[model samples]
Target: MRIIRLSVGLLMLAMVGTGCISKKKYDALSKDHETLRASSASANSNLQTCQQNLAAATTRVSSLEEQIAQGKAAITALQASLEKCLSGANQGNVNISKLVDEITASNKYIQHLVNTKNKSDSLNMVLTNNLTRSLSREELSGVDVQVLKGVVYVSLADNMLYKSGSYEISDKAGATLAKIAKIIMDYKDYDVLIEGNTDNVPISKPNIRNNWDLSTLRASSVVQALQNQYGVDPKRLTAGGRGEYNPVADNNTEDGKNKNRRTQIIITPKLDQFMELIGQAPKTDGTTPQQ
Candidate 1:
């Protein structure tokens, strides 16, 4: 009986030990399931946050692409407008340059005309004054001293120059020619033309064949006297004869014939200086032509 009691005690002890071990293992399993549940909930939260962030990023990308396309279109339009503006500006510059050239040319032409007129008027005034001052009142009345077309014409009666039907210059004419030479010598830039005119009455004499010969000889004689007798320059003198033609009055009347037989001395200014000024080109600095 003692052996059976000890074996039964041992069996009870083994049963109690197994029950405690089973309880401990069950507690550990419960704790491990709770930890796994917490981890799964945290993971699901993280995935939802990631999906929302992806949606925001996609919206921002679409907006940025639309803005880029609009910017490109605006840039293209601006380039086209710039090109058009440049083209218009270039054309306007060309037109302005052409207008400036035309205005400059017109101004040059007008200035040339004004300068020429001024020079002519000034020369004519000087010639008229000098000729009028050189002669006496009685001499001026007998001879016509007039300025026509910038030239001085002195018309003297035939009685002042020569005798009837004679080609020789008289003493009175020589004195008059010497007075004229004084005025002529003062101005070297003048050209002198001595013209002799005669009536239609025919004449035949020694050393004179016809009225033409008489008139020609008279003009030559006056020219020679002006050069040799006075100090007049031979280079500036010219002799001309108009016989029976270009008469101032009718040759039929004696008084008219006498009036027709006259001598004309024409004095003209040289045009070399004026012509040289007109021939020059316009200045590059936009100034007037040189005087």
Candidate 2:
């Protein structure tokens, strides 16, 4: 028995020395090594994916920040431009409004001027037509009716009103004078001026010294006749003499001298409205005058 045990121990030693292992243990070890290798490969793959994802995320974040900065800059530029445009538009509107106001005021003033002129012309036409129709054919023959500068001038020949070198009005002239007084009464708002024109011949009468005095006396006589005899308003009458200075013809000729001897009754409408409008004209400093 001792010899058999010795042999068995020697055999086992020899097998261990030869590196012989059991089949079940070797299989188990191989399986455990395969599982550990799979686990390690999976961990390496996950780490590589995580690093790639981090790099991609960092690049995306940089792109987003750059885009955000650009957007902010664009917004600021747009805001400034909008403000500038608004300011310019506001100023332009103010200028346009002021210009419109000035144009309106100017148009109003010009319209008033036109209205005043039209009114004066209408009055002149009315007076001329009425006076022409009221005077007789015989009376019109010795008179010239016309309107000059808003005044109705009725010029009567000296032969129709007086004789040579005389200041007395004739009895025939009384009818003509009465017609003029009727016109004066009809247009009570008008102002009447009696003007006497004389020839260049010198006068040496008791009450007259020269043509000026003769003309003056003639105008005064007509004014007195209209006021006292015809009931004309004294305030509406104004007498003046033009003598030979304002002659219609040459003083050297007999026909011209006869033409020069005349009496002019000037009737002018009142200018109250025209004067008031003129007073309300706009001032030079781009402002209206205070009422």
Which structure among the candidates has the greatest lDDT? 2
- Window of ten residues with lowest summed lDDT in model 2: 1-10
lDDT of each: 0.78, 0.84
TM-score for each model: 0.60, 0.65
**Number of the top candidate by TM-score?**
2
- Tens-digit lDDT string for candidate 2 (93-207): 9988887777777777777778767887898888889888999999999989998877899999999998667999888999999988888888887888999998888887887
Cα lDDT of model 1 by residue, 194-235, tens digit? 888899998878777887887778889888988998878899
Q: The CA-based lDDT of model 1 is what?
A: 0.78
Quote the lDDT for 266 in model 2.
91
